[model samples]
Target: MTRRCIVLLSGGLDSMLAIRIMQEQGIEVEALNFKTIFTCCQDQSAQVARDLGVRLTVVGQEDDYLDLVEKPQFGRGKGANPCVDCRIYMFEKAKRFMEQIGADFIVSGEVAGQRPMSQKRRDLDRIAHHSDLDDLLLRPLSAKLMRPTLPEREGWVDREQLYDIEGRSRKRLIALAKKYGLKDIPTPSTGCSLTEPKFSKKVFDLMDAPGESRRWDYELLKVGRHFRFNSQTKVILGRDEAENDQLRYAHQLSDANSTASLFPENFLGPRAMLIGPRTDEAIEFAASLILRYSRDYDAGNALIRVDDEIINASETEQAKALQTIAAS
Candidate 1:
């Protein structure tokens, strides 16, 4: 019988190489791509699965994912990223996926010390144990360094054919890619918004707010200049045409918390989404921000559309009254 394995293909070079190595060992491979709202590059992952001729499965996190982000049991990285906790979550799912598909084991491209937060030798061990994967999880890139897994001990995959690569250096991995006749190398990145400091600031803000931060609110964070007026009030100003369209679409959602959306009626400027009360003070504040970021500020007679009505920007105070939380 041909042994099968599920590889965590993140569309990065390391994961791609992991798949290639499994194929070289005459093992059947399936690609699994896990996506959270904050992750990027799914299209690239699809293309990679096609190049390697393996079936790809894309899975998304449940609302419980938000719980982990807000209060991580294992703690966080430099930013708000809960790297260790995140990996455990991913693998717990992968373990189930392996069982569902009747795969012999799970494989990943994780180098022993490549990631400071999650790939430390001890961290790797913790993830395997906590995820309940244990010896069933295999890191082909650093297999030689780890104790023999079921695959190697049972002769399902040759340990000699696997690698022992570790640490931050990519020279050996890059050379191996060439040796496998692989092209289309993707630049290395964490591929997660939580890893960025500025993005994490907005995440912290949403989590710290009084009420719940639903999916819509987190989705909005990806597309605008965020400003906090108070605990219950905040405004998001689009930075470009694309963002303006996004803000408009967000306003139309049935569960949208945006009390009112303000758009430049008589001048060229960004749109704004007002969350919380639509008091006159808040409405005028949104209008003032539109003028503050207007590309054509020379148009002194600028008007703002609130709902279906047009209104002049009354400077309740000033657009810069509150500190800008996140830009664009």
Candidate 2:
């Protein structure tokens, strides 16, 4: 029987190259892409897999994924990204898939010292060990620089055919792509919002706030400007018409925590959602915000539909509450 491998294809040039290398050795390759709420590259992955003529399987993160984000065992990177822990999670799932499909080994494009968070030589070993792959896991792009894996030891894969590329430089990698005759080299992208500093600010905010953070709550973070009224109260205001439609739909989710929604009935303004109470205080705040963001509305002209009631946003409210946090 010919040896086979499952490669983690992130729709990037590195991963594409990894799969090509395996094919060069006559190893049957199946590609797997791990998906999370923060990941936004499914379409790209699908297209790349089709181009490579490899079957692709996309696995999603389970709710337990939230636990690591809240309190990572290995800690976080520059932002809220738990890179080490996240990779371990992905590999643990990949290992299950590998066994299910009887893949001889697992492959990734990670190079030593290429990523500060999880691609260090030591980190790679730890990830492999913890994910229970150990020598069964292979990094073809940097294989020669490291100890031989099971595939190499068992003569299943030729170590000499693998590479020794390391660090952040892409010069050698681009040359290798040319060697493989790969066109349409993909540009680098983290593809996960957790890696963005601004986006992570909102993530940290939700984690710190009172009450359980649900999927809907996290989804709203990607929508618009956010303001905190208190531990039990908050507001989200859309920045544009697209965001306005998104907020309107968010309020209707079965599990949405929104207490009320503010829609501009007679004037142009953003649609806003209230997270907690619908008290006069929250209503007044939400209304004032709609007006503040409205380009062509005044206090008297601003008519906001609040649940079943219509309220006039006063340019006259004593003072707007101090903004706890802005858009992230």
- Most TM-score-accurate candidate: 2
Q: Residue-wise lDDT of candidate 2 within 96-158, one digit each (tens)?
A: 999999888999989899989999999999999999999999999999999999999999899
lDDT of each: 0.88, 0.89
Q: After best superposition, candidate 2 residue 143: deviation in angstroms?
A: 1.0
Clashing pairs in 2: none
Show model 1 residue runs off by greater than 4 Å: 295-301, 315-328
Per-residue lDDT of 270 in model 1: 91
Q: Write the per-residue lDDT of candidate 1 for residues 1-328, one digit (tens) a residue.
A: 7999999989999999999999999999999999999999788899999999999999899888888998998889888899999999999999999999899999999999998899999999999999999999999999999999989999999999999999999999999999998988888988999999999998988888889888888888898888776788888999899999999999999989899999988778899999988898777777777777776544445778998999876444334533444332
C-alpha RMSD in Å of predicted model 1 compared with the true structure: 2.0
